[model samples]
Target chain A: MSVSVSANEVADAPQEARERTILGLTADAWLRILMPLAIGVIALGGWEWAVRANGVPSYILPGPIEVGQTLVRDWHTLSISLWITLQITFAALFVAALLGLALAVLFAQSRVIELSLFPYAVILQVTPVVAIAPLIIIWVDDIRIALLICAWIVAFFPILSNTTLGLNSADHNLQDLFRLYRASRWQVLMRLRLPTAMPYFLGGLRISGGLALIGAIVAEFVAGTGGRASGLAYRILESGYNLQIPRMFAALVLISLTGIAIFLAMTLVSHLALRHWHESAMKERR
Target chain B: MLAGVKAGPPVVTLDGVVKRYANGTLAVQGVDMAIGQGDFVSLLGPSGCGKSTVLRMVAGLIAPTAGRIGMAAGGEATGDVGFVFQEPTLMPWSNTLKNVMLPLRLAGMNRGEAADRAAAALAEVGLKGFEKAYPRALSGGMKMRVSIARALVTKPRLLLMDEPFAALDEITRHRLNNDLLTLWQAERFTAIFVTHSVFESVYLSRRIVVMAARPGRVVEDIEVNAAYPRGEVFRTSAEYAAHCREVSDALHRAMGE
Candidate 1:
């Protein structure tokens, strides 16, 4: 009887396993998507109900439907502003990545240089971008360049510090092995130190993405530059002076959405890069 | 007296080697030994005995404060030495094949040749189909096997292992020990193994150098007259037991010193 039961189990195992996985995945995946979506719907419904029930004016508190209508009505202007903001954000992030990586490598190569210069990086990070934007605009002459500088400053330090730590954190035993093989400095940096620093660099990049967006928005706010080439932040400022509350809220929604989109893109890039090797990106498997 | 069945000319010679750290700690003192070509020697001692320091000095990872360590012509050049740490010490970012191919790539070997050699080395260590597996995906023993494969990928003349299997479970440790010995026999590389386990020292080495701590120095060197390809039967043999007893006694004596 035991032998026959065992045989039956072996025969039924594959189909049973396949059925279980399909059902399991569907349940799990649905919960993950539905939970957040349900919360969002409830919150929006409450907001819409409260606005109507209280008879709040559109200027003071637009309902969710009014906000959505404003977003669609102002799509052309808002999108152009969004494009400008996105351009600055991504440009700042790109420059920050390049400069941060270069500076970190420089720091890795020499202790004396790091000791002399690293305090300045800290100073730049701690000093608020808003505090410096006006002076930067005055000194740089170009408003766009000034805004770019501000965003770059905000996004630079994380990458530099994280990559430096990662480069220095290469396994000591591996360093010894490299030395035993008499590897050159170039080989050590490229083959060992750089690979070790990759996850750390990606981590910093994710943080800097959001920061770059905030920096751009803040710098533009301080710049107060109006018309033609104005970012979403300018749209908010312009709408405030004109009492366009619904348009202002619409701009806020776009900014928040952009920030979320940038974060998701960074996460996807990190997952793709490290899915094969890193603990952070790996999925559980038998 | 140091005695061993010398296999060939001495591949590595250490004469009165001393290592004093920058903080003025006398890590090792007056250590003298010669490892013959294709010989397996274990530096057995408790912690703080500087056995690892001595191994590092031999591998040229660190210079001795007051002694001379000479390697034979074929053993002194770049890529002629391989060192394994107590931990697997693999690059977490790379797959097994890439990790094993590192030395060859560092030495400027072409991609195709390096890949073939790395794959062969992986196969030699029983990791043939795991070339693409990352270190995080592997079990401890499998990771250690990849490390061993990486070490031997260059076919180094001298292999320095500092307690390579000390962190493993007893069963895994024993299996790795057997596999390591098989590799040594097939590769014909001189090995300097560091360990604190008496049974491990007795089972793996042709000669065991028992060391003492606090101004770390060798107290006794005993030779094992057992034959090659020692397996489970040899491990359970009376001869192996006797050798283990002798080494354990020497270790105790060294500790007491």
Candidate 2:
């Protein structure tokens, strides 16, 4: 009887183990998603309760519900501002990527150019965009161009430095192999150096994406332009001046969401490009 | 002591070849070697013996400081040579097919022909279905196979390998060694292999050039009289053992010198 029982248990063991693994995987995945959501809900609930219990005025401390309601109510005006902010951010990011890549390639090709110019790039990065925006606006005479310059300066350095490092980091042996093949200078740059620099470029791009948004917002705050072309930062400022704290909170949420969206998009692009080869994007295998 | 098994006209000839680095180190000195066409030769030595330096000089990667190194076909500047480094040295961003295709592509061969030649080379290295796989997805042995495919894709006149299998495990190394010999026989390319392994040198080369360090120079040369298609039978046979013992003793004496 004991033998029969043990045999039956053995017969059932694989099926039981397989089912448990399937169940465990889903459970782990769900926990990963739901845990953060639960914390957010609890924190919002606590915030709402505190506001109500303390009887804080809407202009002073709008509750989460009021902010959401104001987000919906002020969607028309707020969205236009959001769009304007996005335009500046993306434009700056695009220009930064183009110029940064070109400059990196140039720097990789010549040590003299890099040694002469890299310090200026560093100086531009170190100087606060806020401190320079006023002078740029005054000198440029166009608020948009001035804002772009500010954002570009803020977003350019990482891509330049990262890509330069990556280009220089090609395997010494592989370089020798290329030399053995009598590869041309252009071929070496395109086939070896550029591909080697891709992961580092993408990493810098992710960081630059967030900085671009921050730059645009800060530039708008400094510009203080108060028209239809105003950005989310200006809306926040306007709402603050008008004591519309809920609307101000709504605009702040939009900016944060935009920043999050840009980061996620960059991360997705990096994953798609590098998933096959790069360690950073590859999935862990058992 | 330079007894080489002549196969044909000399493919590469090194006469009093010397290499002194910028930091005042004499890496190789007064090395004279004449590798016959289609011959398999191993530069066998201990570490710091500048075996790699000799190989690099042959490949024209670094110039000899004091002597003449000649290629029969002017192979150095014309991309008529292939080299395998100690590492697999594959571009991680590229797949096996692309990596193997690099030399042909760099030579301005059109895409389709390069692809076909690369695929054939990959098949020759026993990596037929792994063409689409990246280097990261490959095992160390497989990566080395891909590296060999890349080196041979150009169908160069001379193939130079510097300790290419030293990083692999003994089993993989033995397997690759056998595969390499087969490739060399089939391709009929003059091969110059650099290694510190006496057993490996005996197993792979028709001739072994033993070298010593501290102003590195050749100390002894031994000819292996074994026949072609050397395998496990040859590896365990008394003749192979004797050749290995002879090479090992030569290496020991070279080290002492």
Candidate 1: tens digits of C-alpha lDDT, residues A1-286: 0000112212322221222345557556678888999999999999999999999999999999999999999999999999999999999999999999999999999999999999999999999999999999899988888999999999999999999998998989899888877889999999999989999999999999999999999999999998777999999999999999999999999999999999999999999998877878865433
Write candidate 2's Cα lDDT for B1-257 as tens digits: 12334578998999999999999999998999898998999999889999999998888788899999988966654557888889999998889999999999998989999999999888888877778978886777778888888988888889999999999878778878988987887788899999988899999999899999998999988889888878899999999989988888888888783
Q: How well does candidate 2 score on lDDT at residue A82? A: 90
Instruction: Please tell me how candidate 2 rates in CAPRI terms.
Output: acceptable
lDDT of 1 by residue, B1-257 (tens): 12334568899998999999999999999999888888999999989999999998988889999989998887767778888888988888888899999989989999999999999888888777778977776767778888888888998888889999887778778878888887887788889999989999889999889999998999998999998778899899999999998988888899893
lDDT, candidate 2, A1-286, per-residue tens: 0001112212322221222334557556678878999999999999999999999999899999999999999999999999889989999999999999999999999999999999999999999999999899889988888888889999999999999999998989989988877788899999999999999999999999999999999998998998888999999999999999999999999999999999999999999999888889965543
What are the lDDT figures for the candidates, one per model?
0.88, 0.88
lDDT of 1 at A10: 23
Q: Show model 2 residue runs off by greater than 4 Å.
A: A1-29, B1-6
TM-score of chain A taken by itself, candidate 1: 0.91
DockQ of each: 0.28, 0.24
